[model samples]
Target: MRSLRQTTARWLAAAFLAGAALAVQAADPAPIELAAGVYMVPGTGGEPDPANLGRTGNAGFIVGPRGVLAIDTGTSYRHGQALLAAIRGVTDQPVRLAIVTHTRQEFLFGAAAFREQKIPVAMHQAAADLMATRCDTCLKTLRSLLGEDAMQGSAMFTPDIVFTDPLALDAAALIGRPIQLLHYGHSSGPGDIAVYDPRTRTLFAGGLLEARRIPDVGDSDLPRWREALRNLQALPVEVIVPGHGPAGDKRLITQVERYLDQLTARARALVNAGAPLSEVADATAMPEFATWDQYETTHRRNAAIVYLRYEREQLVK
Candidate 1:
């Protein structure tokens, strides 16, 4: 019986290894066309790939007579170049307008590719300012997360057009409806905009509503993030383009709100009980978040941020 058990275990281990190797071998990079004008560009970040086998970012295109409007660039220059090529594949029309959902490099660095083409990049004023001041830090962190290849490919590109609040852009050439930039409070970063396409009723919510994956709260204010998500709930959205995961429906935003609620509650409970940051990190497990790629990456970092705020609150009282 012992001999049989050892043989079976070895076979099982070999089978698992073979399956993993096959999965890696089959994985392909670049974007996939989800619809006529829309494409899903996967990321090549060094971090554990998203469940979709891509990095945590997406780009979109809407072709019209005036020109093509592309939404959010990917992490590296290669990603951006690929995105532009994918857009051209959809329509020979030059990219007329490029708008960003946030200030994160994963979503903005690709804008550099569109510059010489004279495509105007649009973003919120706060994001433009934050990009100017923190571009180096963002670049450094992305380099750390994605390695040298991704770092060399990424370049800082700020928005040429800045909107203080909601602004409707009419791309006369694009096939989609006018794009609306609705400013939600500072949740993910200094600038979080809900990119709404009236025709599709699709809302490209940057990091305000991540689905399945853990929220990146490195520079987040829990209170503000909560408020921002709440504000997002009011929009009549049909589809949601998340910053980090597969595109889904309105439930994406709701699910994220629930996670934030739980994360905030857990942080409060730990602080109330006089637990140390390290202990809280060990204790807080986002049981509801089953699809997170690297559980430790976001969980520990989020806990640390919550702990910092918790300690500040305690000191105030």
Candidate 2:
């Protein structure tokens, strides 16, 4: 098997770059406390239009009486600063820890802001390694897409802490709650991890489960991803904060799993029948996902990548 870092490094290079590029001055949206102290800042799930400027993803925080833990920073330094400002307006506790949820430019870039505070950021070791190697390249790519001014204060950074398994923050001892950092093991990428709060039955699933927007498949093992969803479904989670789009119920798990299953099944069938790689797009036609944002721009590439990955796995076996 390829190293996890190698699997993740291909994520953006595989497909995300095919979409249109645009930039604008966008602020991080306000934070909504979904549970007693769990706050979420919902992103504009819409495409990179003038209105949203492609800021599509969710960032949130868990406030314990003693300290706060944030999950996934926004797309820029400005966004992270705005998020911190929002957190300050609501709570007096200091934001102590930050979690890097994925390797996407949107997910990891804003972490620089947290680093400035000497706040330690944590992520899967695979992800941190990949970020360290490609941080500069990803920054340049973001600069090109969002324009230098929009990305002015933004920077690429590696998380200070890395874990191979889940870690628990015993904030309840000091404050009143405890949070679990779960290393779900290769859903959207080799480095994906999630945050869960037992008290609220809330799970910050990261990109492992998505709502309206179809999850990206560039760095995926369809079978493993599907298995990961089943594992997440088994959790005692009431509300889920998807990596992108809005916060949702356990149904998001089913929605994303079904979509992934259908796409993988169709792609594998076509590959078995000896279909051309380019034809994987038409072969795995998904009218059910027609209404989803970025469908036209991203789906075709998703089909091709999934098909190519299956072909690769078969060769390995």
Candidate 3:
């Protein structure tokens, strides 16, 4: 097991280089109280976590008179604990519940820190199923990439609460914080759940909204994703928390919406033109986000996803 610091250092180096080359340096860790009871935990400049390295870990806290409601755990168990500790330092209130915004390995694995508290860790049914089946593989890959200890302890995480549609939790009751689970179809993951705190106007937007780096289109439905972004924009969101990147403003939602719109159009054009996969991959260019650090790698992957979707559509038709 590599020491956590070592892993951090290595990732930092990678992040620095990637950011510099792309001109997207890590933003400082700026913790902001977005809503009356919500706070945004930003990430410092450095290599991003292996799961979503380009974007910062957009974790947040929802505090009420009762206790704290953790939005999404950070990249590693260590990061999650740090986030947890940060919450504790601010308030002595117990952490009542943790709502995972999606199934991304980084966001879900941090549940270990609060395991002993027996807090109800909840995730969408699709997310829970993915974790149950592929967690071991994810753990092995993470250990190889981030070192064994870079993770919390175990990759096994089961959501105590699972629901298909929107579920509400009252923060005052300690039953859990009042959150609306909107599982938009194949947005970030198969089960992308967005947690909205009306009181805070803070939206924990899993992987749905990538602020800068080319939006990860993997497992994304281009049409639905574009629609989801528009829907998100319609919400009363002041502070936006992304799954992999820093806390953002409404601009994050706008950027993702544009990316989805343009990428789908470009990919569809290429497919209709009878372009090959390699041709489509090479021909596609991310719209006007080249300088947004970490765009190179993620852009390639995004284009690949677009190409794949186009091919899939052809087969279906």
In order of appearance, the predictions have TM-scores of 0.80, 0.86, 0.81
Alpha-carbon error at 269 in model 2, in Å? 1.6
Span of 10 residues, lowest total lDDT, candidate 3: 21-30
> In model 2, what lDDT does residue 162 have?
79
Each prediction's whole-model lDDT (CA): 0.66, 0.74, 0.67
Residue 80 local lDDT, model 2: 77
Residue-pair clashes, model 3:
7
lDDT of 1 by residue, 21-131 (tens): 423432333444433344544443224332322234656666656567787876656566767887776678678778787877667777777775677888778888888
* Model 2 pairs whose backbones collide: 172-177
lDDT of 3 by residue, 215-255 (tens): 67776667787778879988987667666555556888887
Question: Of 1 and 2, which scores higher on lDDT?
Answer: 2
Off by over 4 Å in 1: 1-39, 44-55, 140-153, 168-176
Clashing pairs in 1: 43-55, 63-175, 64-173, 64-174, 64-175, 65-173, 66-172, 66-173, 67-173
Candidate 3 has what TM-score? 0.81
Best by TM-score: 2
Error of 2 at 70 (Å): 0.7
User: What 10-residue stretch in candidate 2 is worst by lDDT?
Assistant: 14-23
Ranking by TM-score: 2, 3, 1
